[model samples]
Target: MSLAPRAVLVHRRTEYEELIAHHGTPGQAAFFLASRGRSVAEVEQRHRRQAEALARAAAAVPLDWRRTRVERADLPRFLFEPEDVVVVVGQDGLVANVAKYLDGQPVVGVDADPGRNPGVLVRHRADALAALLPAAARSGARHLEERTMVEAVADDTQRLLALNEVYVGQPGHQTARYRLAVDGEPAEPQASSGVLVGTGTGATGWCRSAWLERGGPLALPGAAAPALAWFVREAWPSPATGTAQVHGLLDAGRQLVLTVESDRLVAFGDGIEADALELTWGQTIRLGVAPTRLRLLG
Candidate 1:
């Protein structure tokens, strides 16, 4: 007999939880927030709402099905199964945070607070999970929207994935030194803050800001476009490093290559610098469209 499908509820610690963790008690957290002209009641209210949403989500799970809960911090260490239905409850970024760790699993993005987040990835409220979860378990019962994702693979075979964008640069905010080569272009030595490779899903965020700041040279891709947009952040025009190759579009199957000349560079996705690929001098990392797409449920 086939095993029953599992429902994995993913969430991050709330501000209230973090505050209490740091301050040791509610009273202490309240005092700390009061000093900053903030209200602890607001934090407590948000915490209560989050707890209620989680409770509703938990109650929606089918009685016969197995249920698991995971926090955002533990996603890197969490093991996901193909048959598991992934439910992300929190902000839209939480969906991005978990997308890298999943392998074609159907994901349900749940917004704990409706108006708190920009309903990009997390489109549904907690009450919808009661109906969505069972349908998701039934093979091909619901529409699954596939969102494009970017991948960075190092020479050492370390690969990183991002739903929004991947940043390749120094750990600190220093200028990065590298030789950049894109498809149909000659390799050029360039000094810049870093390189950003992003998917259509991420075009509205960092990628859009970078593009607009540079006179909007390239058209940003849509959320489901099977393409990627890249930019060179603040490229320095020096005799040794040229700024000719600053930005471009990467269609499917195309790649942008960067050969590090700096002592060390790190490749991280979705702004999670804590987890990244460390690149050394002479190391080459390839950035391109990932083979895997995020199967987001609508």
Candidate 2:
């Protein structure tokens, strides 16, 4: 017999929860916030909204279906089944956080506090899950979408995926040294802060900021486009290094290859620097669009 479908609810700890965890009690959390000239009431209100949203999402799951909850921090250790229906009940970043670890399970982005968040990824209200979940659980559902993701694969076979952009550089603020070769072009020695390669899903945030700073002519791809854009941050041209190839686009099959020349470099995605891949000298990493897309519910 086929296995029953499962609903995996994903969320992150709210600010109030974090404060309480750190302060040990509500009174202490309030006092800590008051000392910093911040009001704990706002945090509490947000916490309530998050709880209400999560409850609504939970109540909407089909009674016969299996259900489970996974916090953002625990996603790295969580095992997702093929038939799981992911419901992220938090800010848009939480959806991005879960996207990297998923294979092709459809994700339902639930906006806990709608007006407060941009609602780019988490576009659905919690209450909407009542109807959405039923349709999502059905086989051959057409209410799903595929969002492109970027992947970074090191020469050692260490690979990292991101829903947004990937950063390649030193873990610290120090300059990074690498030889960059785009597509089949000749490699150019570069000394800069780092390199950023991102998908269209990430174009509006960090990728846009870098593109605006340099005002590059290349247009960023759309959310579902099979393409990626890359930018070299603070490329300092030296007598030994060049900056001729600063920013460009990577089509479906194209890749941006980087051979590390620094003592050590890190490749991280979607701002999760803590779980990044470490690259030593002479190591090479390739950045390209991943074959697996984020199966998001529309």
Candidate 3:
């Protein structure tokens, strides 16, 4: 009977101490871990080890292997629905995606601080479903870890969280230099070639790499936090193509524009490139930060 009712376990193994420490009761919390991606032999080995570890921590904790509990469940339709806390051991992207299933429940990342009783949480850097959890603007959002769904149901403030980064890259030449306007001011790339805006969260992903490779400065636009806009470096090898098949845009601020100048380019959502657009210039495309964030339990 944790103060938070029930918690959903996200990691594969270990970190059970945190769940036990935070739990008001032993059997109140439910756990789930991903064992699908691995081979049958690997999964079995990992599963046995993790189950033993968890069982030792809290004999009451129920380990469910039904629904995948991911951006999309990978395997095993998780029998577990939603829980109070979600402990994430992987990166922000995975955490953020997992956050979606919990309906914005308190997800903590395992960046546990010194002597924090495993009660530490890493805020997500990317992932829309995660960022929409809650905001500092809302009173309830402040006291996160202790929140229960019943107490914080009406939450609607937008918090932008990106694990990787929100980028607008290019495709023409091996490198592309474009003019960036912060609030409509000229901020061009000097040496490395493109410009990107990043939040502290985004700083962890692409923007951070850009910084390492001389991209540009990372800025947080709070007044318009709900929007995750990217000016784009214009990746069209050819030009703009107006087919939805050519999904990318050139965000110009005025009208959301899209065109096909035989734009030979590719756009990637999360470097996965599984979802990209063939983009061009002059067409104003819109890209804003996601309102939700990825939450994790450390």
Which scores better on TM-score, 1 or 3?
1
Pairs in steric clash, model 2: none
Give each prediction's root-mean-square deviation over alpha carbons.
Answer: 1.0, 0.8, 13.3
Off by over 4 Å in 2: none
Assess candidate 2 and give its TM-score to the true structure. Answer: 0.98
Model 1 steric clash pairs: none
Give per-residue CA lDDT, model 3, range 109-133, as digits (tens).
5321213222223443223223322
Q: How do the residues 142-215 of candidate 2 rate in per-residue lDDT, one tens digit apiece?
A: 97889999999999999999999999999995899999998789999999999999999999999999999987
The TM-score measured for candidate 1 stands at 0.98
Please report how far candidate 2 places residue 189 from its true position, in Å: 0.3
Worst 10 residues of 1 by lDDT: 134-143
Report the backbone clash tally of model 2: 0
The per-model lDDT (C-alpha) reads 0.93, 0.94, 0.34
